[model samples]
Target chain A: MTGERTVGERTIGEQVVGEQVAGGGSGTDDFYGRLRAYEGRAAVAGGEGRDAVNEPMIRHWCEAMGDTNPAYPASAPPTMLQVWTMGGLSGHTGGSIRSEAYDELLALLDGAGCTSVVATDCEQEYLRPLRPGDRVTFDAVIESVSPRKTTKLGSGHFVTTRMDIRAGGELVGKHRFRILKYAPARRSSAAKERTTEVKEARRPRPVINRDNAGFWAGVAEHRLLIQRCTDCGTLRFPWLPGCGACGCLEWETVEASGAGTVFSYVVMHHPPFPAFDPPYAVGLIELAEGVRMISNITGVPYDKVRIGMPVELEFLRVDADLELPVFRGAVA
Target chain B: MTVRVGDELPPLRIPITRTLIVSGAIASRDYQDVHHDAEAAKEKGSPDIFMNILTTNGLVGRYITDHFGPHVRLQKVAIRLGAPNYPGDEMVLTGQVTAVTDGTAEVSVTGRNGIGNHVMGKVTLRLSLDFPHGEADSPQRGAR
Candidate 1:
């Protein structure tokens, strides 16, 4: 477990310290080789949880979550698998194993100016129930380091790690955590505006896949469309590849009659985005044809949106190039 | 509480606000920017910031366990995502007991967001053969 080791197509070192491994591509790839060296290596060991699974903490968590599951005091939420291992406000100072290779990889990134970090995504699998008095322990490994990727948050590498949570040496769950450590993306003044005009105009392009391509095409022509299973004659909204009723893969489109009612809706107020205005009514409209579709509700104030409110199909020209299907609130 | 097949669990209506999404993500130790930042989410081809699957999963777990009370042990939660739960929306969760055995039950749940069904799945839960919620926690009643 000393100097250089060869794994697959690349050569890595167990104790390479901070040696910058020259990469095969551009500046983005400059330090990838060095970062990738930490993969498959142990990053933390002998990590003891802050406290054993208990009722008080579970109650606190449940209260914060507004979860009234009467099962928590008797049994912990499977989703709280990682809470036991958290370092908390005390930080990762005690009862946890820290790996030199992992620290060095982070340091290398810090030195290269990709300092800001953000958690991207994680997947977890529960294997056993955690009850009160279960003393949790875990060990983590540097799972993988993705090559450089440029995102809206800037350019960086995605570092993923896997942790095994054990209770009394028996595996209870597994958590795969991924994070992006990178330099923040630069935004133009136009995008930094706080006015009503700019933020409402920068709508992100719709993601169109083969299954739903015709739906967007229909929108461009001022036609509200629904997918009808040719085999079963069943109607569906927001098109899908196959019919749920018959599993038929063939389908055809029928123009909507431009009628519907508000089945449900929500008004956004915080964590503002660059496109949609806050307190705007985004509704799930149950069309006259029986299939439901979601779109912005207009022709009424935000608070006026209500269930069973009449609405009609209309096209909204968000920007010079983007026209989306919207529903106009009709007279009561 | 004893549950029988066809027992309907009261639907839980959760407001799809940015705070709700962000708090849930952070509580779960998830730091993915897409869960919290909208502009960055747009860069990733999403309409706006959308709820992560984990949050939806956690909600599903809570939705079932909440109904079964605290004694039910979740054996498995298999779910598939359908639509995104964007902010400015509401998620209505509904569940029904699908099966019941000697000491366990199977419940099917569907959480519908504005876009469509945000998550749809089943939860296999285990508990004592017979018990009541108030009595189940009597052992730990005064530990507070």
Candidate 2:
């Protein structure tokens, strides 16, 4: 997959990870390498300007990321949706240069002799809600570069990239990503310190029970559904045994518009659980029915989804019995 | 139409202190001294080294957990970062209930640096709608 680049006649939805000849270029060893690199980034960046995110792309992202939120109104994750906007961040060029931007960046930093590169920190500020069918423009810049530090990965550099996500000149989100590039540390103090401070894994493993069986089924169908208490007329999520108010034991499922607003959230630099990636976002979204559910936010660019902004839901299939639910703003 | 869509939670203000930053760092496994070592941060060109983005995000998640109690399960949170907040910079964490269903709810979350928005994001939580609290009523163990 690294050398060939001609847009082969591979059928749609086919998982192709090999090499293909590109346009009329001689398959020189080094030439093909550079060309593949160039083609890779170009495809990722895509053609810039309006219409950056299309329905098919969104669906593909949602499927790959296993994000399920109603905002996608599909079985996908909002976080994966942000990748579409990142493509626009490459600018409005349909040329191979624009496509090669992300890879080039990786190659540039890698070529710069940074030992081991890893993501140390990330902060995504959602300025506005990102909705499906919205064309967004984005620009990313290297905001800062920190000196190398000793760690298990060795001495590394911290590079921060700031991406401003926008749609029709309106600010959507501000995403700041901090990447660490380091070499193996030889028993350095920094390595010991980081190792000592490592957080114990605590994954959020909600059990799959009968109460939530229906909700999981909805996910299989790409639907967002909730349950309500029949006795106290209360609403619940993750399908529970009793009412939150009247202590009622009976409940019924309800399908929602999957819209809500930011009640509160935090940026977690630590990995509370092994399943969760570091620099993760944890938040509480208040539904219109006076209910609050804990879920991850995804879809829109990091900088575009913000507090008090509107959002919707999307469901991601984690397994046959479990589906992860993610959220994004309903309107951007 | 008198139909329920989502519900709002009580607003909360969290003190953005050195301790808060420390707890988040510990929870996130982020050992950057800038988050804990004020002196080291100053040496690194930071104005007293503010909380890491990971800590900021964890705080947001904690806010929801605190309000909803332990019965509710957090599914996802999408947040962003803004101006660097030092130990002294207080943050106002807020939320809004935008949509609701029988068992699930969606909320938007925001964290501000005293003056303006420092972190903006959203979350979706799941809970038992029938009972006053879900079967899992016990609060989760505090982050180590």
Best by TM-score: 1
Compose the digit string of candidate 1's lDDT tens values, residues B1-144: 556667789999988888778877666555667888888775554557777655677788888776767766777665555556888999999998766664666677878877666666667677665653232223323442
Model 2: share of native contacts present? 0.03
- Give residue A65's error in model 2 in angstroms: 29
What is the Cα-based lDDT of residue A245 in candidate 2? 81
* Each model's lDDT: 0.74, 0.55
Given the true complex, what DockQ would model 1 score?
A: 0.08
DockQ of 2: 0.02
Measured with C-alpha atoms, the lDDT of residue A225 in candidate 1 is: 84
Task: Give the per-residue lDDT digits (tens) of candidate 2, residues A79-185.
Answer: 33235443232343454423346556556546645534444444454544556556776666655554333343344445556666677778766655666654444
User: Where does model 1 exceed 4 Å of error?
Assistant: A1-30, A93-97, A189-332, B1-12, B16-57, B64-144
